[model samples]
Target: MSSLEIVKQYYTSFNQKNWNGMLALLHPEVRHEANQGDVRIGTGKFTEFLQKMDESYEETLTDMVFFTEPADSRVAVEFVVNGIYKKGEEGLPEAYGQTYVLPAAAFLELKEGKISRVTTYYNLPLWIELVSKPRND
Candidate 1:
């Protein structure tokens, strides 16, 4: 499969919250560089991260645009993340189902049709501020 197709399928599975489907597209030793976090290696680490996120937040990705250059194996994607903080995280403001939307970008490297590395970037302060504000409802 082409890199574009692989990436498209990955996101589609992600949107569906199909954890197995998403993990199937990744290498066993996939490298993950989560936004504002240390680089983690292996699918085990990725699964743990997903579990933690699932516990703390409910999120969806929207307005996605994927970019790739000729002769490059990397794909960069821009999207908006809309999320509700369901539980408080360490060193973060309290969570009371506060919803926030923010634009983010991710760079992915594919190896033999499987994602080997992923690095994402997003505004942490903007998210914290938005989620920290007092909710009217």
Candidate 2:
């Protein structure tokens, strides 16, 4: 499969919350880096990370911006992830109710049809603002 195909497969499985499907596309030593303060490498760790992430989000990956440059062996995807938090915290207000959308971009490096490395960027500050408690001071 080509790099673009691999990326689409990743997102498609992600949207479905299919951990095994997503894992099938990753290299055994795949390294996943995110703006969310987690570093995960290796298939086992990566699977655990993904499971936790999927559990954290009330909404899933809904839309994707696609790239199809096969020569680069890389794929760049921009997407809007919409979800709700049943329980609120510092990054999300409790009384504000449970809906949030964070726009994100992820870049992936592929080798032999599997993801070797992935870097994800997103607006973490916005999430903080949405979830932050109002100060009494």
Candidate 3:
């Protein structure tokens, strides 16, 4: 599959909340550069991250626009995350099913048609601010 196709599938899996499908596109030694934490290597670590995220939040990517490098080995995607904070995470605001919308982007590197590295970026403070506000409902 083409690099763009692979990335499209990656996000499709993510939107579907299909953890195994997302993992299927990754290289065995895939490197994940998280937005606000240490780099995590391998699919195992990625699985743990996904599990934690699944426990704390429910998210879907929207307004997606994808860009690919001339070499076809690198892909970048810009999207908005529409999410609900379902459970509290350490060092973060308490969750009362708070909903938030945040813009985010991710850069991916592909090797042999598999995602070898993924680096994601998002505004943490903005998210915190959005979720911290008291909801009328």
Candidate 4:
């Protein structure tokens, strides 16, 4: 499949919370960077990250637009996240199922038929502010 097709399926799998589906697109030694975290290598590390995220937050992406270069090796996606903080997380604000909307982006490097590297960007402080708001909970 094309890099763009892989990326589109990646987000579709993500929105479905399909851990296996998301992982299916990764190269065995895939490298990943989440938000501003240090780079992590391998599909195992990526799996752990996804598990942690699932435990703390529930989110869906909306208004997604993708960009690909002529070389067909890289793809970038821009989207907005509609999410709820389901539990308090370390080094972050209180959760209590706080609702938030935030913009995020990701860049992917495709190798062979799988994703070799994945990097994502988002405004952490803005997300904190949104979830920090006094919730009726």
Candidate 5:
């Protein structure tokens, strides 16, 4: 598959909450750079991160726009995260099923048809403000 197709599948698996599918597309020694967090390597570490995220949030990506380098193995995706703060995370605000919409972006590098690196970014302050407000319903 082409780099663009692989990246698309990655996000599709994410939206479907298919953890295994997502993992299948990743390189064994995948490098992950979490938004505002430390760098982590390997699928095992990625799985741990996914588990933690699954525990604290339920999110879907919307308004996705992808850009690829014609002669490189890089792909960049811009999207908005529509999410619910299902559970409270450490060092963050309490969660009361609060909802949030935040703009986010991810940069991915593909190697041998698998994702080898992923770096994600998002507005932490905006997310904090949105989730800080308790849901009315």
Candidate 6:
């Protein structure tokens, strides 16, 4: 498969919350960086991250727009993920069914048709608010 196809499927798998499919597109030594400075490496760590994301949200990914330039070997994706709280999360100020439309982007690097490195850029502060976890004490 081409890099673009691989990346596209990656998003599709994630939106579907298909852990197995998502894992298949990831390199064994894949590395991921989110908005935070923290860097996650290894398949185990990546798997954990996916698990947490799935466990937190109630709905699946909705509208998404993908932009790519074949020459650059990079793709930028913007999407709105709608979901509710899973209940019993300490920072959760409200119950389930709260709707959130988060606009997020990700920069990806492909190697051998697999995702090797991913740098995620998004408004994390906005997410905190959407998830009802205000940073202010």
Off by over 4 Å in 2: 70-72, 87-97, 133-137
Residue 92 deviation, candidate 6, in Å? 6.6
Q: Tell me the TM-score of model 5.
A: 0.96
Instruction: Report how far residue 131 has shifted in candidate 6, in Å.
Output: 3.4
TM-score of each: 0.95, 0.83, 0.97, 0.96, 0.96, 0.80
**Candidate 5 residue spans exceeding 4 A from truth:** 134-137
Sort by lDDT, top down from the best: 3, 5, 4, 1, 2, 6
Q: Which stretches in model 1 have alpha-carbon errors above 4 Å?
A: none
Model 1 C-alpha lDDT per residue in residues 46-127, reported as the tens digit of each score: 9998888889988899999999978568899999998989999899999999999999999999987799998999999999
**lDDT, candidate 4, 1-137, per-residue tens:** 79999999999999999999999999999999888768899999999889889999999999999999999999999999999899887789988988889999999999998999999999999998898887674
**lDDT (10s digit) by residue, model 3, range 5-107:** 9999999999999999999999999999999989999999999999999999999999999999899999999999999999998899999999999999999
Each model's C-alpha lDDT?
0.90, 0.78, 0.96, 0.93, 0.94, 0.75
Residue 134 in model 4: shift from native, Å?
Answer: 1.9
Model 6: per-residue lDDT, tens digit, 1-137? 76778888998887777889989888899889977757999778999877776676665665777777866467777776666666434544655545667777788887777788888876867866786654353
Top candidate, metric TM-score: 3
- Model 3 quality (TM-score): 0.97
Which runs of model 4 end up more than 4 angstroms from their true locations? none
When summed lDDT is taken over every stretch of 10 residues in candidate 2, the lowest stretch is: 88-97
The best candidate by lDDT is 3
Off by over 4 Å in 3: 135-137
Model 6 poorest ten-residue lDDT run: 87-96
Compared with the true structure, what per-residue lDDT tens digits does model 5 show for residues 1-137? Answer: 89999999999999999999999999999999999778999999999999999999999999999999986699999999999998998889999988889999999999988999999999999899998875577
Better of 3 and 6 by TM-score: 3
Which scores greater on TM-score, model 3 or model 4? 3
How far does residue 105 in candidate 5 sit from its true spot (Å)? 0.4
